[model samples]
Target: MITLSETSLDVQQAIQTATRLKAGAVNVFVGTVRDNAKGKAVLRLEYEAYEPMAIAEIKKIVEAAAAKWPLQGWAISHRVGVLQPGEAAVVVAVSTPHRADSFAACEYIIDTLKETVPIWKKEVLEDGEEWISAHP
Candidate 1:
């Protein structure tokens, strides 16, 4: 499953989607908006994306991960629009027959998604705001 949500991301929903009877491990990664960045106090984050393109890129990442491992299920939920500190910006969950596979697949999904997905973020700071690279 893949989602681009303007509202808060549902972490548990992502986990549930990836849970399977054949899976022994379900690894989850939740990325949250931080309170600070590079010596600046972060107030919030505003995310923008070409939704169709972003989703397509994320699907490609998932397919690549499945080719690398034996996966039971996988789900990715990314939040777009304004987000406050401590709010979940993204959720990635993957289920596999073993703990290691789940861990590796989950990591790959998040890392690759951040690097390749067409999601842009503006870091809103106490003093100013700036657009940052997705890979950064």
Candidate 2:
């Protein structure tokens, strides 16, 4: 599954989707807004993306992960636009015949998404807002 929405993600739902495939292992990743980044107080965050490119890139990551791992199921979802502190920004889940594959594939998806996805974040601070790379 792949989706872009402003609504909150349901991890149970994601896991359910994965488990329905008779997977022996399931791995999940959830990224949330932190109150601070590099010691800078983060009042909130605003995310914007080149939607077409972002979605395409996300699909590519999912495909690569699936191909590289013996995955039985995969799902990735991301929330866009304004997000308050502590809200989830992204969720990824993977299920496979073995636990190791599930963990490795899930990590690959999230790390690659941060490195390759064309998503940008703006930190809203008490002083001002500044755009930053989605990855550290």
Candidate 3:
């Protein structure tokens, strides 16, 4: 499963989606908004994305991870729009026949998604807002 949602992220659903009977491990990664960044106090965060391109890039990442691991199932959900501190920004889950593979693939997916996806993040601080990476 892969999705870009404007509502709150469903973390348990992500984990359940990646659960497999043949799996020895199910690894999950959740990224949340923090209360601060650098020396500024963060009030909230707003995310935007090039929707079509972002989904396509995620598909490519999922394909690459599958090619590199013996994955049984996987799920990824990313939230868009304004989010408060401690709110989940992203969820990644993967099931594999072994613990090492599950961990590796889950990490790879999140890291690669961060680097390659077309999602952008803006930090709303007490002073003002600034775009973080302008790319995800």
Candidate 4:
């Protein structure tokens, strides 16, 4: 499953999806908005995406990871709009019959998403704001 939503992501839902495959191992990675980036103090973050493109890119990452790994299940959820520090920005879950495959695929999913997804972020600081490229 893949999702781009403004609502909070449900970890349990992701877990359940993986569980359905009767996987022996499941790995989940949750990315949260941080209070600091570099020396800047972050008040919040706003995510905006060219929706159709972003979703297509995310789907491609999922497809590639699944094809390269022995994945029993995989899921990714990315949050949009305003987010406070410590709030989840994204989650990627992967399950497999073995621990190694699960871990490796989960890591690959997150890494690929960061590198290829078309989601852009605006850092909202106490004094100002700046837009950042998703991969940089």
The TM-score, computed over Cα atoms with residue i paired to residue i, of candidate 2 is 0.91
Q: TM-score ranking from best to worst? A: 1, 3, 4, 2
Better of 1 and 2 by lDDT: 1
Candidate 4 per-residue C-alpha lDDT over 5-48 given as tens digits, one digit per residue, 9 for 90 to 100: 99888888887776645788999999999999878899999998
The better candidate by lDDT, 1 or 4, is 1
TM-score leader = 1
Range of the 10 consecutive residues with the lowest summed lDDT in candidate 1: 127-136
Which ten residues in a row are the worst by lDDT in model 4? 14-23
Candidate 2 lDDT for residue 44: 87
Which residue runs does candidate 4 get wrong by more than 4 Å? none
Q: Please give, for residues 7-116, the per-residue lDDT of candidate 2 as tens digits.
A: 88787777777763567899999999898877778898888877899889988998898789988987888888898888989889889999999999999999999899
TM-score of 1: 0.97
**Candidates' lDDT values, in order?**
0.93, 0.85, 0.95, 0.86
The number of the candidate with the highest lDDT is 3
- How much is 132 displaced in model 4, in angstroms? 2.2
- Runs in model 1 deviating more than 4 A are none
Clashing pairs in 2: none
Query: How close is every model to the real structure, measured as TM-score?
Result: 0.97, 0.91, 0.96, 0.92
